[model samples]
Target: MKFCYACGSPLIMKDLEHEGEVAYCEQCRQYRFPIYHSAVSMVVLNPNEDKILMIQQYGKKDNILVAGYINQKESAEEALKREMKEEIGRSILKQRFMRSEYFPKTNTLIWNFAVVIDSEDLSQVSDWEVDKAQWFSFEEAITQVKPDSLAQRFLNNFLQEYKIKSKDFFA
Candidate 1:
């Protein structure tokens, strides 16, 4: 960070004990922590827990997990519900947090969860950001997501952890 968020003063790298090379504002006499946006992502499950909803956005062919940024003053759980309703037109019936991962390219810290939606709500309408969406079997979803992408990473990590935990919420 070149400038301080508090005083609008220039910041320089200063090494504090136990914290190496932090952005220090001379005018404010404080170390300014790094800033990043927080978001939420989901491995949205059907009520039967047999399938997951994936989406195609920005004209991309690869299907990805539904995700959106957490709004100001919104909890991760709140964002999860909001994103599901906004993007997939479904209300989350239940949710279980899996984990979080930070993406440098987007500068976003993403909280990942496994959420179940209403079983009777079969119809899905994509929002403007999402061009299309579809449900896939767990096996197919593992193979269908884009290779080496953030969505794929989050899905794999969550599934692996879920498996180790004997399918925490999905089971």
Candidate 2:
């Protein structure tokens, strides 16, 4: 940030253990750490853990898992449920914490969650954020999905956990 949020003075870089070098306001004697936006990416799986939900956002060709940034006062689970409802009109029946990765391109730290919901209950939902959503089998996704992307890694991790042939991923 160019200016301090607490005071109207200019911000300077100061080393802080919480987040490395941070913006410091000399006038207010306050330090403001660079905030990384927290987002969640979910691999929505069917009850049988066979098919996975993939989505294509507007202006994007590659299909990706459902993702959204968490809002203030919202937990990771809440964000997951909200994104699912908004993107596919479905509710998560169960969820498991997967992993987290830092996305330098968006300055975001994405928390991955594996969620289970009845695929049969899914209804037709439309949103400006996404243009297409479909359930793809493990074989199909491993073959068609982008080889070098977070979505592929999430799929690989899921497959590995289920004792599926995860070695074939990106092979």
Candidate 3:
């Protein structure tokens, strides 16, 4: 940040004894404010129980789940629904909490949910934020996308939980 919000003075990067790395303002005698980003993502599953719906990013073309940033006055659930409609043009039937991960270094928090949708047809999908939508099997999805990405991590966790639940149901 160029100017301090509290006193409107210029900010400078300085090594702080207690805080380690910080932006300090000489006039305000305080550290610069930090910014945080909040995002929502959904792991949309079809009714077949064999495949998961994913989007091929327009710019990246990487296999990723439906996701987007939360707007100024929108809730996480609202953001997820809006993103789904904007990206894929489908209505989500139900959404269940999956997990949340925070990247302190990047100041980003990703809230993930597992959503149940009607089908995997992508003919009506929108090409706004996403280029196309496709269904990928659990094994294929893990092998195709970046291993360290939030989408992959969520998929892995979901698969484990799904398998356990299935086994319990059968037993």
Candidate 4:
């Protein structure tokens, strides 16, 4: 920041007392302001219990799940639903908040959700943002996509949760 928000004085860079990071205004005793971005992701499962919906990225051509940024006046859940509709043209059945993580390296807060959808409703998938949409078994999805994608992470978590929930229900 060039000017201090609290006081309209020009900011000067200097080392902070406790933290090594540089401060914005040393004379006015102001610290540097950090900005964070919000992102939303969805883990969508099919009714057949055999496949998960994945989108082939238009830019990278790699398979990924439904995810996007939260708009100016949108909630995390709303953003996920909007992204799903815009990318795949399908409506989600049931959704539950899964987990959230902050990536300091990217200054992004990622909100993830697990959603269940009917397999028969994949007829009107969109191709504007995504090149193609396909359903893959858990094992096939994990092995086929890029290792560091959000889809892989969601699949791993979904599998773990599914196993635990199924075991508890059965036992």
lDDT of each: 0.86, 0.80, 0.79, 0.74
Best candidate (score: TM-score): 1
**7-126 per-residue lDDT for model 2 (tens digits):** 779999989876888889999999976668999998788777668888888778787888899999999989998988887888888787878998888989999887887564545555
**Regions of model 3 farther than 4 Å from truth:** 1-34, 104-106, 166-171
Better of 1 and 3 by lDDT: 1
Candidates ranked, most accurate by TM-score first? 1, 2, 3, 4
TM-score preference between candidates 2 and 4, better one: 2
TM-score, one value per model? 0.87, 0.79, 0.75, 0.75
Between candidates 1 and 3, the one scoring higher on TM-score is 1
lDDT score, candidate 4, position 101: 79
TM-score of candidate 4 to 2 decimals: 0.75
Which structure among the candidates has the greatest lDDT?
1
Tens digit of per-residue lDDT, candidate 1, span 52-164: 78889998898899999999999999999888888888898888888899989989999989888876364566668788888898899999998888889888986787667
Per-residue alpha-carbon lDDT of candidate 3 for residues 1-171, written as tens digits (9 for 90 to 100) = 678878888899888887787989999788885767888988887766678888877678688888888898989999988888888778887777778998676677889888877667777787667786788887887787656787889888888777778534212
* Cα misplacement distance, residue 60 of candidate 3 (Å): 2.0
Model 2 steric clash total: 0
- Cα lDDT over the full model 3: 0.79
Winner by lDDT between candidate 4 and candidate 1: 1
Q: What is the Cα-based lDDT of residue 67 in candidate 3? A: 87
Model 2: ten consecutive residues of lowest lDDT? 162-171
Candidate 2: give the clashing pairs: none
Residue 126 lDDT in model 2? 58
Give the candidate order by descending lDDT.
Answer: 1, 2, 3, 4
Name every residue pair that clashes in candidate 1.
none
